[model samples]
Target: MNRQLTNSKLLLKPASASPALHRVLTVPQLWGIAVGLVISGEYFGWNYGWAVAGTVGFAAATVLVTIFYITFIFSYTELTAAIPDAGGPFAYAYRAFGPMGGFSAGFATLVDFLLAPPAIAAALGAYAHFLNPDLSPQWVGAVAYVVFVSINLLGVRDSANFSLVVTILAVAELLVFMALVAPGFQLKNVVAHTDSFGWSGVFAALPFAIWFYLAIEGVAMVAEEVKDPRRSIPRAYLLSIGTLVVLAIGTMLLCAGAGDWRQLATIDYPLPETLAMVLGKGSVWTSLFASIGLFGLVASFHCNTLGYSRQLYVLARNGYLPAFLGQVNERFRTPHWASIVGGLIGLGALFSGTTDQIIIFSVLGALVMYIVSLLSLFALRRNEPQLERPFRTPFYPVMPAVSLVLALICLLAIVYFNLLLSLLFVGLGAISLGLFWRFGRQRINVHLTTLGEAERH
Candidate 1:
């Protein structure tokens, strides 16, 4: 009874005492942030799927992953609208479960957001290498980390506006590339390796397939910053998913059909190189397109930097991490320390692992988050029936259930294929949870924001 009374007191404590996050984002800006966070996948990571599954096998894997994201996003948006917290899944899981649940969700999300930047940074380096063979991609990626983190430190509004412009340019570049490559689309090239790897390879390709829409959920991490999140979240999510689906399928087909799919499967700058295949190595079109291709990579890297910092800031603010990370800059009202700290972690990851390894760890983290988040949705619906869900999920239990089941399947497939790495991931989770269980459990023993407060929002 004493513990319960203490928790109740903490729950009712006013959250306004903490510094306010700038609620300046609108629907268009939200859409840009959503799309921008995942655009780099189209540029680099998805091609690796082809390495494991061949063209047709990888395509099947991508379709399954796409179905998961579409259903998951529709269902997940409800939680975002209802809770409106910067911690994303961590906050939702806490309200649904408890401190242990919140820490679990936070840890998984941290892995996803923190690890993703280095993978994208590696791609930036690869694109740089493509542009100038003399440039070291790792060094170039290192420079990117510094530049974009500085941009984020400036402020959220400035950061988001940059995302909008760069996302538009990235989307335009993609459309143009598709237009140029469409005329040369060949069924023969696409089907050339149709049965080479067979059905088993499709399972092996699941993690790589996830790259197509890996960070789309990141939009939810900034929910506290969105203006009128109740109405804006659903609109922005719908638009973002539709745009990515079309782009993913169209880009894959065009690239496979451009030439032998095998040749482009291993490189980071596949789209530009695909154009080069059609237009020749020295063609002006290939040169200019490759130069502009940096926009898409830059957009994802920049937005992801924003996403991880928010994750770090919220975790710290809620007592899951060191309190220093939660401190906001008085001048910019941004999470300056969070951005810098997350970037430093990303750089360490960049040097320690290969691009493929980094991608697998990131996707693994994503699947864990998906599972935990879906479980939270179910628990919250049952226990907190009165929670003001601005956007209720379509089909309720069925939609969330489908997302949960698919997430389990993807998680199993990835573990089966990458056993060693999966073990390492599990080991890391265990260590973090073990430490939290021993040392700091009391620090976040109360719900910082009660469901009553969330419902009012």
Candidate 2:
């Protein structure tokens, strides 16, 4: 029965009474979504070393690292313009490699989304300690998860607005920190190095650096939601990436100027610590500002949860999984159930292990998704040469090829430093492939039989 359904093209037709699936999200809203992914405490802890190293290791290399993110955004913009659909990686994979490949891409992306929220929530909880030293980390994490999920369940517009407000505040807080501390900038502090930069240190730091830039592609996930997605997505993508790069670099400089490199590296939440040092322990204003920035980091996870759930819904609708997940909430016009399911998975992560462990797994999953996306782009171009594309990736073959190579290097670095996390990802992929083959074959058979019945009639 499922096989017939899978093969049946009749179900693919749009329903007359069915409202348009695509929602017209504004440019700022789209930008908020991208920012939600990029602006986080996780970036602060993990990528500080990489950004500093990139800046000082080799001047030209730092520039390349900065440009790498911009280049990636442009490439993804082309993909979004070509296929402004909800399935995201799933849709791209489907068009490029067929059903099995699509299922794997979609499944892997779902894993990445499911793991991200809890990790972010935990990070928020950890940072919250800087404010209230006595609060329990688990309680903080749980409260954050509930609050963020509640906002998303309310509606996409509400969530987007919340994200925008938080991002604005977060950016403001960072700017304020920089403004107050920039005067203290010392060249001697900027060049201070505790550890030597070699192939091993660079490789060790690769996973951490990739984690910082991991979610830039998140803009592509919401392609269908944006108004004039073709233009809006690209603009939002480039703008958000640029903003994040500047914010990251400036923050690095502020930290360097505020204290020694070793001291900055040792502290977990460097920004707040730096603020506390410069303003003194009794400064309530700086503390409040730092709290707002932490709130923004929490909001970023909320945005990620929504984006991932919607992509899962699109995948389910395409016969890659259970059909029930595709149902949209009539009142909210959001995927309420899928969002809940995603939240549960995140909550489970909180119970499953330590925050550091989750971070490692999340980083590994993101790298795999990036590699697949890069390859999918190339495959689609070769397979569908005549397909209409509103935005074309310049230097097509070469650009994507370069992305692929960089992704591989990042992946290798992950495997080298974190074999256990790498193995878990591989295991998850294998399970997803097995499920897809079993379920997809059933769908295909049902679809074929339905076609035969129609012929007989």
Predicted model with the maximum lDDT: 1
Q: Quote the RMSD, in angstroms, for model 2.
A: 3.8
Please list the residue runs of candidate 2 whose C-alpha ends up more than 4 Å from where it truly belongs after superposition: 1-22, 41-43, 47-65, 266-268, 444-457
Local error of candidate 2 at 59, Å? 9.4
Cand. 1 Cα-lDDT = 0.88
Give the backbone clash total of model 1.
Answer: 0
User: For each candidate, what TM-score against the reference?
Assistant: 0.95, 0.88
RMSD values, in order shown: 3.2, 3.8
Error of 1 at 67 (Å): 0.8
Model 2 over residues 19-120: C-alpha lDDT tens digits? 335566888988888887767743354534443353254223334445556666667777777777777776677666667666667776777777777777
Give per-residue CA lDDT, model 1, range 1-457, as digits (tens). Answer: 2333333333223233556788999999999999999999889889999998999999999999999999999999998888878889888877777777788889999999999999999999998899899999999999999999999999999999999999999999999999999998998999896666988899999988899999999998888889998899889999999999999999999999999989988888898889988988899989998899999999999999999999998877776777788888888989899999999999999989999899999999999999999999998898778878889999988988998999999999999999999999999999988877775565565443353355458
lDDT of 2: 0.68
